[model samples]
Target chain A: MGGLAVIEVVALDGDDTLWHSEQMFVDTQARFRDLLAPHVDLDHAALDARLLEVERRNLSTLGYGVKAFTLSLIETAIEVTEGRVLGRDVQAIVDLGKALLDHPVQLLDGVPEAVDALTGRYRVMIITKGDLLHQESKVARSGLAEDLWAVEIVSEKDAPTYERVLRRHRIDPASFVMVGNSVRSDVLPVLALGGRAVHVPYHVTWELEQPDHDPADGDFPVLAGLTHLPACLEAMGAEAA
Target chain B: MGGLAVIEVVALDGDDTLWHSEQMFVDTQARFRDLLAPHVDLDHAALDARLLEVERRNLSTLGYGVKAFTLSLIETAIEVTEGRVLGRDVQAIVDLGKALLDHPVQLLDGVPEAVDALTGRYRVMIITKGDLLHQESKVARSGLAEDLWAVEIVSEKDAPTYERVLRRHRIDPASFVMVGNSVRSDVLPVLALGGRAVHVPYHVTWELEQPDHDPADGDFPVLAGLTHLPACLEAMGAEAA
Candidate 1:
């Protein structure tokens, strides 16, 4: 095909790409801080740092998802309170995690249209990293499952993961385009594999998911929002074709 | 191929089939029952029944895995104790879940050799369900990653799920053979997909995974253990060939 049609497959990230998720996490963290307020003297900043530390330590063992986040929250609560944290408070934290898991999946404006537009000319898939059931439920609830060709719920979104997905789907890197919110996850990895990526910034980015290196340094387009994705991909396809 | 060489692919269940998992869960449940003993008047049977009830209710929402199991444990504790459970006990439950997540994956007797033998002739994959990260970690630690063709970690094991996996991997159901411990999750689903299955009983089966109908009524073999898998598969292959 000579990579003539440089975008035969369009893979988008699930959370914060097609729908809102990190904001829910941010709100939950705020509530988590409040839940520990009366028990511990730590300010919100210190509490967040300590929680992040615990999350980092547990990341290797627990991986990521609501469950891991909840576990880290409980551990942080116990440690911050020196085991004096109240049972009711613990229950509150558990309730918060459950609520977050039960949070309704709200699609970002224009996500459905953009995905549908891209699906007309390209194979579309959701490449998300989180708990399998949780991600699957969100995708099913998002009203986009039927629009996409496949939904990949992975544990991590690194270069190897992107490579595996592409290889399994039998897509050439030169003809694959990934669109997502996280540069660290959706952009750099796909770019590393000689594929193209588009960065659409989400309002809330998880601290751990923040890109260490500036995304501007990468050779990819940063659209104003997911709404601009269709036009952007169309222009790229025209230029390549 | 005329389905002449039946059983082109052999997929094995991870938990209980390849490694000891349910016994660990059984041990954790005992500990959970003990932790709630002093806080409630319910006897062991009552507590067990209540916990199972909560698990069933949460199963649809939380799905399954150690995290779901742990969340159910904490919820059951709080409910049974009427919100009077101690923070220390909640922490204990979280710790139990973490330890289970960190549990060493002990392969069943003859698993490695059996998998190696199967891989020599047929394409082999680990088709298991649960937390994606947990299952991935167990497979990675089980020292079997280098042997198998792929590891499929699913959310639920049902007929449609089996159909999806087989269709995705381009494996014909007629040439696929599934071996696992649970008739409900492993055997029945594959059987419904027109694939052959072998039931290898684990010493301990989770209450939720128990088959309602007797497995004996199904047209599949129930082996004494995984150690006998090779011989059984060999006989079946010879019969088909």
Candidate 2:
């Protein structure tokens, strides 16, 4: 507890951190590449880069979610095929989007236990960014709803968003710890706002959410997995005591 | 100043109430029928009936919004054509969704004046139900954001939902007023919770939201148009005075 390390609230990221999310996007993109192989020989890297370009452009208008992703896929398909995209290809992409939406929520290593462990001891809420319907679907299907506090589905994860959420609940950011898989969204933003964060790396990450720089010393703690969360919190608690 | 007439907050339904919403759905469905005419000779009424059936079924699974509407169109297209729906039709329907998403928000008559008039006099919030993104798009594009106290994009408009929104804002439901076009969603539910309601009928009504029967006496007040809202509130305020 070197300086204000006592945790009174825990904010969890929905995708990849608590459950498998990025993997679906990854799989969808791979299938997209295969679907268009005959029309173009663009490698996966180049195709992904093109898709990201389209997604970033559409983000302002479309925001984020599976629907936006599906739109980007269709836009990319049209772009690569020079607007000669076959009718079947467009429908196939739509089906891919539907599959992503219909996919079941898969909880990672230690979800309810980690969240349940901190329930009464700390005010816990899930703060995740994505389409509200898609995010709510993940929450409803996750079966982790009752074990935690409210689930906030926001447009983006930034300092202002974090501040608003924390202040609304009357929780001081200094005592708040955000647990998630992205350093860019989950860790750095919280740290910037004087809140604590714990990084639990997933097997795959969304390319856009990757941070350009590394975390410096005293920035935040990195956990091997969610199972290690209670220990980390307890150690911090001991230091504070 | 009839009875319990002082108003502290005004909750407006987003689509149809504050802006044109159902008309867009009607126009899109028209185009859908035309596209499928070559495969099936179903009349507009029959086509609309089938689409509604599919939508009701998907409501539990897909929820609502432009995205769900597009998916339902695709599903209906497939069902009517016995899985022989052309790829071109799928692309065409997707275009319709994008168009709806991209449509400019047209504020109903005197919406700004109504919301602005009530802004400082009461806590004003838009309680809209639909796809969060679609509803959000309308709000963002409506140019009415600055006047609203808050915009609550919800999944359903039931008694419990209205109760939760009111309790969250710490407003006594008795002093709150709900204004919208759907009696089923806006009037009955709010009135059931002992709140007042103002019904402003839209030109077109979605079949699902149409009330099964007429509202009884003392159900709520009815207005000819949104232009009449400020005056109605004033009358109520005068009564309480």
Candidate 3:
């Protein structure tokens, strides 16, 4: 907080941080787990692991997004059902994916206000990693478009990607602050690059996005929600006083 | 040619224009066709039709790039063979995809030089549409990275996408020229946006990328190869003079 005087750029992550994302994936997966349970003799944990295995295996080819997730679900279904997955179940997964895509943009509490508050004072932008069209559409639907300076829909949220974003924008890493939900992605990457990051925990985090280390043990600032952001920044700003 | 003075940005398409892209896809599909041939009574044309059908059907959800193409191939194999596709054949498709991913970058003749010729005079960029990581990796591997201003790996190439790119880069469409292989993607979009486009036709075009209208019959400049680009530009420059 004491080093806050140097901060100039505020980059926000989409998905869970700004809106409800992983919950849709989680809910659908839960239903999928139950739907496929009768056909396969596995319990919930094992079933989850099976789907995760497919997702991890297909990550290189499929990448991340609802389409990839849907494909992975179908593959998982086929694998568990021994290639006997019902046509109806595959249709259900497809429908689930469609619904997720069609899901209305429900911005998290205090997001619009938080972004508005952070806009004029800082170089505000949204740097999210997902399917370009999907992410772009979500941003369009979120109604936060006019408030921010830029929307960077990237492929990943690794340290190098964050560094590249900084480099692209001609922003010094020391003066950038990244805010997001994922410790592995939004928090650690920017932190590693000597950029500041504030973690705002989402209730449902994707398994792959969970950090290896205990997130609580990390030195980066963690806040309960975005509504606390203005106060948090103010406290840091006061430190400069 | 008369509009040469208006040109300020030369945005090149990556895949087929700068390097050999669809050739790899064509080759893999050929191998896949052979692998699936004995299992079905369909001829090569029929097989190609089946694969094309599946690819068209999945284009929306699977999106574009080698990953989607590979998934489409697998799904086609499953559908055509009525779920009788052998495990070895499936492995072959996976290996085919991996091989495509690992394929060496082959720059087209005189591309670097053509881009180099235009670099200093214009705001050069490479704007390609595909899976984000895949296209980004292609640009990195293409060795033309340093020769351009920026590499935009977009979800789609349409008038709106081009408009967005121009807006992002602060480029004027009237002063922009897009060069690429596909008429559907590279040429028409920019042309529709009042930007010029040069068609450098690749021998093998994706079926989906074939413009509905004949490009040869259109008003935009069409060149045989990348080597001819500089002269074509010079002719336009002469018109302006």
Which candidate leads the pack in lDDT? 1
Q: By TM-score, how accurate is candidate 2? A: 0.85
Q: Residue by residue across A1-241, what tens digits does model 3's lDDT show? A: 2243556888999999999999888888888987887788998899999989988987765678876677677777777887666545555666677677778989999888888888868878999987776888899899999888888988888888888888888888777888899988888878777777889999988888878866444477789999888777666556544
What's the TM-score of every candidate structure?
0.94, 0.85, 0.86
Candidate order (TM-score):
1, 3, 2
Model 1 segments beyond 4 Å from truth?
A1-5, A214-217, A239-241, B1-5, B214-217
lDDT of 2 by residue, A185-234 (tens): 89888887888888999988777887875546246678888889988878
Best by DockQ: 1
Q: Considering only chain A, what is the TM-score of each predicted structure? A: 0.96, 0.94, 0.93
For model 3, how does the per-residue alpha-carbon lDDT over B43-75 read when each residue is reduced to its tens digit?
989999999998898776557887667767877
lDDT of 1 by residue, A1-241 (tens): 2444568899999999989988998899999998888988998899999999999988977788998898889889988998888777877888898898898999999887888888898899999998899999999999888978988999999999999888888889889999999999999988788888999999878889988776454578999888899899989888888
- On TM-score, the leading prediction is 1
- Candidate 3: list runs displaced more than 4 Å: A1-3, A57-62, A74-99, A214-218, B1-7, B31-47, B50-54, B74-99, B214-218
Worst 10 residues of 1 chain A by lDDT: A1-10
lDDT, ranked from best to worst: 1, 2, 3
